[model samples]
Target chain A: MAAIPEALAELVSDMESISDRNERAELLIETADRFGDFRVPASIASKPYPEDHRVKACESDAYVWAVDRPDGTLDFYFDVLNPQGLSAMAMSTILAETLNGQPLDSVAAVNSEIVFKLFGKDLSMGKGAGLMGIISVVQTEAKKRLAAR
Target chain B: MSVSITERGYVNPGVLVSTDWVAEHQQDANVRIIESNEDPLLYSAGHIAGAVQVDWTRDLNDQLRRDYLNKASFEALMSRIGVTHDTTIVLYGDKNNWWATYAFWVFQLFGHTNAKVMDGGRAKWEKEGRPLTREIPAYAPTAYTAPERDDASIRAFRDQVLKHVEAGGPLVDVRSPAEYTGEKLHMPEYPQEGAIRGGHIPGAKSVPWARAVNTEDGTFKPAEELKQIYEQEQGLDPNSELIAYCRIGERSSHTWFVLTYLLGFKNVKNYDGSWTEWGNLVGVPIEK
Candidate 1:
């Protein structure tokens, strides 16, 4: 198993640090805001993001675009505007913020569900559980990227 | 059956009115429209006019217990949500009304028999270009009478489910096909496998929750079709002692609503502990 990317591990640690359910929800909302704005290529600007890597089983339409920068780190852009609002966006945002600048293996290393247990009750475990779909597809893409090279 | 009754089912069927009915009845002194979405935030995005939001996690569930709220707190919630004993509530929301049906089941647990689930849920209403708004409705509180939450008739505990299973009684495992066979325990469960012990309770039938509803509209299939599928295609004995389960019981609530109200079957209990309990038990019999 690949080791967790450092930045992502810290986010998981912070999430684990909050034992209070209410405080965890507050932190989740704050974390959702951590991803500032959406961006995409000019070509598909008016089109739907290719369903090339579909996040199945999740209720929302979530997708990840893989971009391997010249620095040998694989960056990912996320279009995870879950129709639900904060809870839906929170899990996606955490993955986007943590995995954006990491290498392919680092992205592959991520068992992103580390953050799943931190939410529920006042907010809901389902909210954070939304990340499960993204986690599977993202790591699958990373594996393909590594195999091709 | 009329579309209104088809969507809402026949038991206390008056609660199952049309969206057009909701549109006309919004101002009706006795009606309340409540949106209970899987995504709690979707209510603020846009909702049917005169509807209130019920966040299952924040509103219906008890803060501390794995169980639902107690009767006194349930009364307070009714008051908080502007629901009175006599109010006829119609519930609709995302996830093909999965969460909405679960919400309806929770209300029934408190003996709030006036509630009905919207047919086709939010997806159908939105598909038809029905009017939606960001506005939330407010209502005056009434002295809501709390029912002594009757669990025996509707709910099945772990022991009951085990006994039912051991007796070769009817059981419906309403999870995805993969989950029922232990081929995959992927989605809708906690963390992952959620159970170190995968597979299903022995002798359970795999009738996925999705089969009960039309994928396009989220409305249940016609009653005849539902009967054909549940009774004939699946061979579920409607008159037998029956129970349904999913990972945590939410999905099964959808099935429970269908079997009890739509199909009008009696003696059905939703095993709320479901696979989460059965799969994890050390000594329970499991089938892959």
Candidate 2:
């Protein structure tokens, strides 16, 4: 597993500590709203199929891109193009917050099941948690960048 | 030759309306624009000026249960959201209106028929460069009463789906092809929402939810095309009792929308408790 970046460690704890199922859902919604506030243009956000970056596993046309920081860290930014997919957006925020400032080596090794470990099996996620599965994609992206370096 | 996307040959032309039509009626007291997206926060980013957000996982869902809100709760939601009996609800959202259609299906579950989908949903509107706002509406709540959800008409349970299969009824697997065939349903990290066994119901047909809608603008195809695919290609009779399903009920709701509303099928139901239930059942029949 990759090392948890200090910035996102707090968010991970915050999301994990939410006891109320409904409030947990709300937190995801809030995180998604924050993402929307960034207002990433459609040209950038809309990644159609076969772009390779698209999160096709889930129903939404979501995409994730990781940029290498000058300090050799990875910054994660994602867009779950579906407006209703707050849970997916929250999943991206989790990765962004957790890995954004982490070293490339650690980011590449980040575990995709971090949520399963964090939330445990309490998430009554239906049809698998498509958005949460995105950690693997982000980690892979980070690993590719690391290899390029 | 293709027909106009806006004008479809159907008995209920009211099922789908254009973004321009929605724009013209934004201020109509009788109409309410509800933005129901796959991503929860899209409404906050900048939704249609007068539109309100419907949280499928919150408002429409039973917070404590896997099912939807009970009738009383649904009625209360309708009231709180300022929806009345006659209010013309126009639903729109991202993912080519998947959740929008799911929301519409839920509304139908409660016998709310005044609702229609905004053609192309959030995608089409945004593509057309329509105005979007961050104004969270604070409309005056109104009197909205809904009957108990009529499950028998527009919804399907596991037992019914099983029997429907036994009778060789028309069933549409609206999931992606990989899912319909029961392959690649999960990952090493995430436990995918799939049945223990893969494949589909014995007599089911794979329609692939995306086929019903045009991918470019995220709008549904013309009525004739839809008819051709579901009827001519898939061999579904308009008079038969059709059922649509996916991993969850979400994607199938889009297909249900195509059959029930667009094509004017007399009896169509969305198996909201779709693949998850069918896949998990102990003794149900499956087809690879």
Mark the regions of model 1 whose C-alpha exceeds 4 Å error after superposition: A1-52, A73-75, A78-127, A135-149, B1-15, B186-193
- Expressed as tens digits, the lDDT of each residue in A1-149 for candidate 2 is 55656655666677667766545655665666567533335655444534677765665556777665788776666777665465666677667656777787777666566665444344335323665557668778877876787
C-alpha lDDT of residue A5 in model 2: 64
Kindly report the docking quality category of candidate 1.
Answer: acceptable
lDDT of 2: 0.76
Among all windows of 10 consecutive residues in model 1 chain B, the one with the lowest summed lDDT is: B1-10
Model 2 lDDT, residue A94, Cα: 64
Worst 10-residue stretch by lDDT in candidate 2 chain B?
A: B185-194
Error of 1 at B190 (Å): 3.2
DockQ of each two-chain model: 0.27, 0.28
In candidate 2, which residue ranges exceed 4 Å CA deviation?
Answer: A1-3, A15-101, A113-130, A141-149, B1-6, B187-192
For residues A83-124, write the lDDT of model 1, one tens digit per residue. 344554666677777777677888887774574554433434
Query: What does candidate 1's lDDT look like per residue over B1-288, in tens digits?
Result: 335564543454554556677778877778788898766446765789888888787777777867788888888878876878778888988888888899899998988888887777887788788888867677887678798788898899998887887898888999888888898754454543366667888888889988988876777876778888889988988788899999888899999998888888887889988887788787888999
Report every candidate's CA lDDT: 0.74, 0.76
Q: Identify the candidate with maximal TM-score.
A: 2
